[model samples]
Target: MIRYPAYAKVNIFLKITGMRGDYHTLSSRFMRVKNLFDTLWFEPKSTPEFEIRGNFDCDVRSNTIYKAYKHLLAATRSDKLSEWMETHAVCVDKRIPSFAGLGGGSSDAATFLRMCNERLELGLGVEELAEIGANVGADVPFFVYGYESANVTGIGEVVERFDEPLLDFEVVTPQIQISTPAVYRYYREHLYAPIGAEETARLESTPSRTILASMTPTEANDLYGAALGCYRELNEKEGWFFSGSGSSFFRIKDEE
Candidate 1:
C-alpha cells in the first residue's frame, strides 16, 4: 500500500502571451501551498476499483487519478501490469476544491503518477513522467516535476524551477465553478492581445513578488475582467485577486 499527498498550488503571476492553434500560450509563476492538499491511497488488489471521498463531486470513472493509471499502463505496454492495475484499488480523499483554478485535479493526477513509479519500481525519471503527464493536463507536468516553485510556460510544458521568497497568503473559494474553457473563450473575444517582446522580457526577468507588487490591473489576470464581470461580487471583495481561471481568489497576508 502507498499513500501520498497531492498539494494545492497558487498562480502568483499569469500572463496570456498569445494563442497556439486552439490553445492559449501562458507564462506564469506557480507555488505549491503547504497547508492545502488531498490524500490518495493505493492498495494492490486482485480486482480493480477506485473511489473518491471528501469534497469531490465528480464522476469516479472520469477522475484524473483513474485516467493517470490507465495512461501509465498504456505507457508501460505491459498486458500483465495492466491486468494487475485493473485489480488495484485506489482511493482519494479530496481536500482541494475542484474547478477553483488551484490545480487540484492536475495535482492528483501528477501525484498518482509519482506513486505508481515508486511503488511499481518503474525507473521512469521526472522528465519522463512529466512528459506523460502533459498528455493529461497542462499543469500536470509542473507537479510531476516536483518543484516548490517554477516559472511555467508554453501551455505549461515548460517548467523552469526557481526558489521563491517565503510569503504568507490566504485563498478564498466562492461557491461557484468557472469552466476553464469558458474563461479562455471569453478572454479571446474580449481581451486577446499580443504581448510585446519587451513586455515578455520584463516579465521573465522580474521576481514574482516584484511583479505582484507592481502588476497593473490588466496584467494581474488576463481572464480577471471576464471572471469578475460574471461574478460581480468578486469585485466587491478587497485585497483579493483571481487565481487562474478562478472561482477562487487569494490575498497575500500582511507581514508585520
Candidate 2:
C-alpha cells in the first residue's frame, strides 16, 4: 500500500468576498503546515463493504472520503475504482483535528481522491480532481492542487498558487467541535459585510507573510467574529490568528 500525507493548512488570511447565491464566496490564503498531517493508505478490506479505518466520530456514509469516492464514481464510472475498493480499505491515521478550521476532512478527502486516481489509473488531472473535490468540501481543492501556498477564492473553487515564503506554523485546536455551516449561517444572517472587488484584488495580490505582519486576527479572517458569536467557547488570545471558520488558532512558529 502506498501512503500519502494529507497535510493540514492554516488560513494566513480569509476574507468574505460577497455571496454567490447561498454560498459565501471567500478570498483566503491557504498555507500548509509542514509538520502536521494525516496519513492515508490502502489496506486489505476486512469485511464485505468499503471500509475506512480512522478516528472519526461520523459513520462511514457520512465521511467526506466516502463522499469523494461516490463523486469520483459518478464523474467517471471506473470499474477499476469499484473493483479495487471491494478488496482494499481506505485507511487513515489522522493527526489533524477535525472541524477545527484546519481542513483535516477536506485534506483527507482530497488525498483519497488522489490515491484513487493514481491507484486505479483514473487519468484525472489536478483540475478534474479538484472539481470532484469541490463537491466534497470547499477546502478540498486547495489540497488537490497541493501548493505550498495559494489564494483560494470563489466559494472555494478558484485556486491560484501564491509565491509566498513558507513559514512553520504552530497550531492550537481546542477540543471544541465547530460546525462550519452553522458559523456561515450565523454570518450570513447577522454579520455579513462582504468586501468589494478592489479590496478583493488587493488581498489576492498581497503575500501572506506581509498580511500576517499587517493584520490582526479579526482582520485576517472574516469568519472569526461570526465563529466566536456562534460558538461562545471560542476565544481570542493576544497574538494568535484564526484559521478558516473557528476553533483553531495559529501563529508563526518562532514568534515570541
Listed in order, each prediction's TM-score against the native is: 0.91, 0.97
The regions of model 2 sitting more than 4 angstroms off are none
- Worst 10 contiguous positions by lDDT, candidate 2: 45-54
Model 1 C-alpha lDDT per residue in residues 1-256, reported as the tens digit of each score: 5579898888877888888999999888888877788888766555455544445677877788777877877788756556656767667788889999899999999998998788767888999899889888899999998888888988999999877674566888988888889888878887787576687667777776677688754467777877766666655355566788887777676721
Clashing pairs for predicted structure model 2, backbone only: none
How would you encode candidate 2's per-residue C-alpha lDDT over 205-256 as one tens digit per residue? Answer: 9887788889999988989999989888777888999989868999998887
lDDT at residue 51 of model 2 (Cα atoms) = 90
Tell me the whole-model lDDT of each prediction, alpha carbons only: 0.79, 0.91
Tell me each candidate's RMSD, in Å, in order: 2.1, 1.0
lDDT of 2 at 26: 90
What's model 2's overall lDDT? Answer: 0.91
